[model samples]
Target: MIRIENLRKTYGKIQALCGIDLHVPAGELFAYLGPNGAGKTTSIRILTGLTRLSAGAAALNGHDIAAQSTAAKRQCGLVPQHVNLDSELTVGENLDLHGRLFGMPAATRRQRIAELLAYVELGDRVHSLVKQLSGGLKRRVMIARALLHNPRILFLDEPTVGLDPAIRRRIWSLIKQIQQQGTTIFLTTHYIEEAEFLADRVAFLDSGRIVAVDSPTALMAGVGHWAVDWVSDAGLQSAYFPSREAAQAAGAARHNGFTLRRVNLEDAFLTLTGKKVATDANAQTVHGQGHGAHAAATRNPTGGQAKKGH
Candidate 1:
């Protein structure tokens, strides 16, 4: 339902996206995995008409994003990484505003708002101000608002970025539910396990390029079924093995302690890029580095600055 060919985006001397190609079939849950500054958000911005691409083409469903911008945009909903809802607006009011922006009729807006609020399990918070909701509740409200228009595709950019693990899992289940209902989902996240657990297929992006695209299991298999990690003079290190027995044998040889675990999506990414996908320190660093450039690069396509926090 989504297609891209030789997509490129440049911000001054920084090449945010470097001629990448990707396709996500209808009803598929596709994950774009990368560390910050890897062009994941840049790609989303282009697809959603929030920013212009420097070269190449992207289409939603079958409409070209640049040529048929309205049709292309109509096919997708976006839940941005940060909370962008109006703090003063009540939950229902926030969703109602989005529905109206989509030109939804008042009756339809009310119906959809109610349905989506219930779907996201926020039926009781409809009258609460956005600022009064917890982080997890706000995230749920965002999801509901994004779905207010019933777009066929949903783009969740770092959907659970700051939520606790338990809340993240709850959001994960909600995401899965949406996929089951036939929405083609495009997710970008730094959390390795999130992609591993949720995506039917995942693409690893780095330095504005796509290095690999495959099923999570296939990607993990490429790096072996098991991993043995140990602390070394060079810092933490890992070895991949084809089987648990092999991993155990390898670990037994180490004089120091080792961690024996199944090879995961993080291991696959590390093997390919020599960089960790998600770390507390790394997340903080990258989140702080790109705001200025990002703001400068984005254009609303509606004769105004794109909304902040998106």
Candidate 2:
């Protein structure tokens, strides 16, 4: 469970988060969807104690993040957007260090490392150096390390970025498995289909604010079930219809060639914000900070200094 109320964050004159309010119930898979510079990562950094909020309140489970930082942090694990594991260390070694950081006993650390390695299907690769593993394997190892402490909630920022579709699907199954096991997951991702397929509810954040929050199906329904796409002087444009028949009729009436398809989460986001969720893949926050800084800030899960401006 996570609660955020009137949460605001600013860096100089740039406001990364503008008083967004959100609540994620226990055992829910909640996706925060937005293009870059939309405050998605800023919100995660604030919740995980990597970045301080300028104003307002956030709590993990029932503990206030600012007032009860330790308790609040104890309830969550984070898999950052970029791979932050030590390349020199073996898979088992990397996870062992994370367990120690959380103050786990040596025996417990070993047990958890073995169990998580097997859980993530990396049992055979435990002895391999991190640099020796593929990107997908590395991502799986990160997931295992994050779960090393058995935190009740998991914060995944772009969990499947850069992986091929097949590997991405594999990661999706792993994420679903984690949710089914009762961990409340808070996810931020650029992949709209990933959120549509994996999340129970999603929040659309744009220009530092939450524009909409609802089930993916509900949001898609709001925009209609079918879409007719046609190229125009304005580039590509789309029209939504309540049924396939209506969409076909509309497409037939178009002077230009048109394509008919089902409406998707991206359509819902575009309809609401007039922006595509996948725009600006390498875009930075208004303050011009990237995930590299956040990775450095979160390397030590228990405590680390974060630079201002996310």
Best by lDDT: 1
lDDT of 1 by residue, 176-196 (tens): 999999999999999877888
> Model 1 Cα displacement at 141 (Å)?
0.4
- Model 1 — which ten-residue stretch has the worst lDDT? 301-310
lDDT on C-alpha atoms for all candidate structures: 0.87, 0.86
**TM-score for all models, in order of appearance:** 0.90, 0.89
lDDT tens per residue, model 2, 170-262: 999999999999999999987777888899999999989999999999999999998776655665578899998998798888765666667
Model 2 global lDDT (CA atoms, 0 to 1): 0.86
Error of 2 at 276 (Å): 1.0
Question: Clash totals for all models, in order?
Answer: 0, 0
Number of residue pairs clashing in candidate 2, backbone atoms closer than 3 angstroms, sequence gap of 3 or more or interchain = 0
